[model samples]
Target: MSNEPVSVGDKAPDFSLQASRGRTVSSAELSGRPYLLYFYPKADTPGCTTQACGIQEALPALGRLNLTVIGVSPDPVSKIDKFADKYGLEFPLASDPEHELADRYGTWVEKSMYGRTYFGMERSSFLIGADGHIKAIWRKVKPADHVALVEKAAAEL
Candidate 1:
């Protein structure tokens, strides 16, 4: 499967979705701050949790750089809420149940687990500038040190 990826210097695609914060977050509302938009497979899973909590732990430093962290997954709002609460994750975790945002950003993909191949959301992240342009793109990310990388990118912004 191939997708036309959003790249550095490209204008970020607009989106409006339900976030665990109980708000409909839109690209327009995120215009004034550098934002990190990360897409993961599911809530409360190992790698996804690791990636999310990493961002959570680094939120303070990221915020100091005026960066807003947001996570998107196909899970329903209920699951997203539970995961956020369980982890004390303060960032907005948006629900992309239809994966419109993921498809637009090229995070939707095909994967295999024990020979079961299916379409799914790839673990990815996009750093969007205050001007709404893609600043960086990370694909096939490692959850462990992911947050630190985002923090470093925020520092450069």
Candidate 2:
């Protein structure tokens, strides 16, 4: 399989995943509108929680920008649901349990930690334009500063 990553100006890949909102969130559904598609390592983890809550805190600004946010991870739908419910996350948290969306987005890769290696989803974010093309990308995102970066990008978009 080609490991080429998704880049700015490429058409966003199509996906259909079960989301925490109890329905499928597909690319088609989000078409014709600019949205932030963010990928994290897992649901309910410390870093992921901080990233998610950061976005939640910025929802007012995001809404004013006319943008929607969707967070994707390789966790099961149940886990995503619990995370959202527990944290009162207003955005949809999509389940990518089989890594279909992660693979399609090229965020699933071999990662090394403490001299051990394994495959996992990289923390990344993609800004998709109204026309469905990527406008910006944040690969290996830092949770602490992700929302601010997205806010900047969204303002430019």
Candidate number of the best TM-score: 2
TM-score of 1: 0.96
Cα RMSD, each candidate = 1.5, 0.9
lDDT of 1 by residue, 1-157 (tens): 2378888999999989999968778898988778989999999999999998988888888879989888999999999999999999988999999888999998988899998999899999999999899998889899997887888887998
Candidate 1: misplaced stretches above 4 Å? none
Clashing residue pairs for model 1? none
Clashes of each: 0, 0
Q: On residues 1-157, what C-alpha lDDT tens digit does candidate 2 reach at each position?
A: 4468888899999988899969778899988999999999988899999999999999999999999999999888898989999999989999988888888789999999999999999999999999999999999889999999999999998
Which 10-residue window in model 1 sums to the lowest lDDT? 1-10
